[model samples]
Target: MVERLRGDWPALEHVLVIGEPSWDEFITTPWEDVRDPAVLPALRPDPNDVTLLIFTSGTTGEPKGVMHTHNTMVAANDPLPERLGTTPDSVFHMASTLAHLTGFLYGARLNVQNGATCVLQDVWDPVEFVDLVERHGITCTSAATPFLHDILRVPDLAERDLSSLTRFCCMGAPIPSAVVRQARERLPGLAVLGGWGQTEEGLVTLGIPGDPEDKIVETDGHPWPNMEVRVVDREGEVVPPRTEGALQVRGPFLFVGYAERLELTRELMVPADDGRGDWFDTGDLAHLDEDGYLRITGRTKDVIIRGGENVPVAYVENVLYEHPAVEAVAVVAVPDPRLQERACACVVLKPGASGFEFAEMQAHLAEKGVAKQYWPERLEVLDELPRTPSGKIQKFQLRAQVVDGPAG
Candidate 1:
């Protein structure tokens, strides 16, 4: 990866390798040496000083580095220990990449801050996850929605003793209602909570234990402490509750700025009446309930317009997840000469399941009372959906495949 980027980022000076020997041309240092008491400095920096730069996942476009300050990072995770019910004896299991904000905050930082034991996994395997939970007595963990689906698909899930696993905070995508319902039926001790956030804003909202089942599955919980969320139309005016619009957020945890992209950062910010340039446009379509809970409808670019009608991709995907055969699913737009674009439900079936035809899918939609125009016109079965490391389905890849023609 370094070699591939060397040409474009020629100014890159040094590379430090952790857990592995550095290449001959670069600096080599032991991880333990950096932590030596003699070499450590007692330094106190300003809370506003930049502490980290986390890059966006770039599922929609190029990744940009988001800047976070010391104060912001602390504000981002301060509520986690109490919110997640993380006691000193609680064990945190992490399977997602730490490069992402969710993994960095909940997996690493929160564990250290809360004085909880952490179990790390280099790669995700459902069986291994169950084993680790059983062995370590893991009490809580967070991951993308797909991880939950994969865990549920483990053939021996019923045979495993996963009572130690109590809380699963799901992010990256909307939690399919069916997945939540099935998880409750299968693991009565577990609470599968939904959440919403991005690298630009750390943990904007999270579902808590004891929320109604409908709220846990349908909404992405209420906003984090001191964070304000608003739904607005194209004109930047606030919309009525329960109405879909662009989601905007402003809080102490919001990124300081995009690293070295001041102009681009300014464009994404909205001026607040309090003379603070705070509100950051999230580029997500969502609605706030009367009680201020959020339901992410879709991304601004992920929406599919079929014959001038908008198809709710997330809603459709959630409904399709209820089908017994679907192990995983993604609804993407397929270019259509007439309708501009049409909905295609790309599905991954369970090991021994079959008979998922386009007509059968249409019948299922009809049974669920989905509008005829919103029903997917085509069905594509694949071994798996293309996903980012954080387990977010890369819809752009599926759209590209559809435009380029079917793949074998």
Candidate 2:
């Protein structure tokens, strides 16, 4: 890869490879050696200069490079200190990759901003996580819902001493009610907070530390300082509380634009009717309650149309997650001749589960009082759902797999 890049760019110079052997004019050095004062870059970047180009998770489509200026990146971490309740004495831990915004902002930037210690995990392991918490006295960590679910299932979790950990800020996906209940029962000392955000905009809304169970489980939480969120209908008019609509965000923490995709970036910008500023359309369906808490419903493109009726994908998936036999569930659309698309439930069963029949799922949904039309027409059992490194489900890939078959 280095040779290819060097050949493509004639002006390429000063190659440095960390933890690799030197060969063919390439310089290799230990990772720790890069921190030496002599090897650091002397140039200081301006606040307006683009310093980071992070890519979206690509759950919806092809990943786009989101450009963030130094000022924007710094602003992204500003609200986190107060939101996560981090302090100089706190010990942070990060399992998510730093390439993503969650890890970049919380794992590295938050620790630097708060002057706290941070432990980096090379890979995610629930058992190792328990040990890390006890070993490092980790106080605060931010990761996706899947990580919290895995930690609850650790065989010796009951015996582990994890009281040192105070906060578990869940992002990238919604937290189910079942998981929240389980966490409350098992780890009473720890707070499990749900949050919502994207690669373009850093963490936006996060549940407060002492929120009630309903706020922690049902809604994604309140917006952070300097960040504003609004749910607007198709006509761009703000919707009333409890009505689902397109989610829009406006904040200083937002990225400058998509790299080399200026036209695409402009399309997402909606001029604020109240004249505060331009709001970035998040492409997510959400609703705000009377108390101003945000509840994410589903992606605009993720809605399933069955017999000309819309199926609430997130609602149905959350209902299925309540089943004792189910560990993870995702509701996706499958093409049908009569109805444009039919709802299909893709599920990963917990250990010791034989099967989750379609009849059983229908019965579970009926017991939960879900409309028959909203229930998934089919149940497809899988070993595991396809996910990004940050643990967001790849529904597009799951839909394709359900329609055709898994790639060889």
Worst 10 residues of 2 by lDDT: 22-31
Model 2, runs deviating above 4 Å: 7-12, 19-43, 273-275, 406-408
Model 2 agreement with the true structure over 1-408: per-residue lDDT tens digits: 878778778987666665555443344445455577665555456789999999999998799999999898888888777777778999999999999888898887888877889999989999999999999999988999999999999998999999999899999998999999999899999999999999999988999988888899899999989899999999989999999999999989888899999999999998767877789999999999998999999999899889888898899999999999999999998888999998889999999998898899989999999998898887899999999999999998988888897422
Which numbered prediction scores highest in TM-score against the true structure? 2
Model 2, residue 386: displacement in angstroms?
Answer: 0.8
Give per-residue CA lDDT, model 1, range 1-408, as digits (tens): 997888999789877676556564244545456667654554557789998899998788778999999899889988776677778888998899999888888777887887778898889998899889889898888899888988887888898999999999998888889889989999899999898999998899998789987789889998888899999999999999999999999989899899989999999999888965479999999999998999999999999999898899888998998898888898888888999988888999988896588888888899999888899888888888888899988888878876687633
TM-score of each: 0.89, 0.92
In model 1, pairs of residues that clash are: none
Which whole-number lDDT from 0 to 100 does residue 136 have in model 2? 94
lDDT for 72 in candidate 1 is: 90
TM-score of 1: 0.89
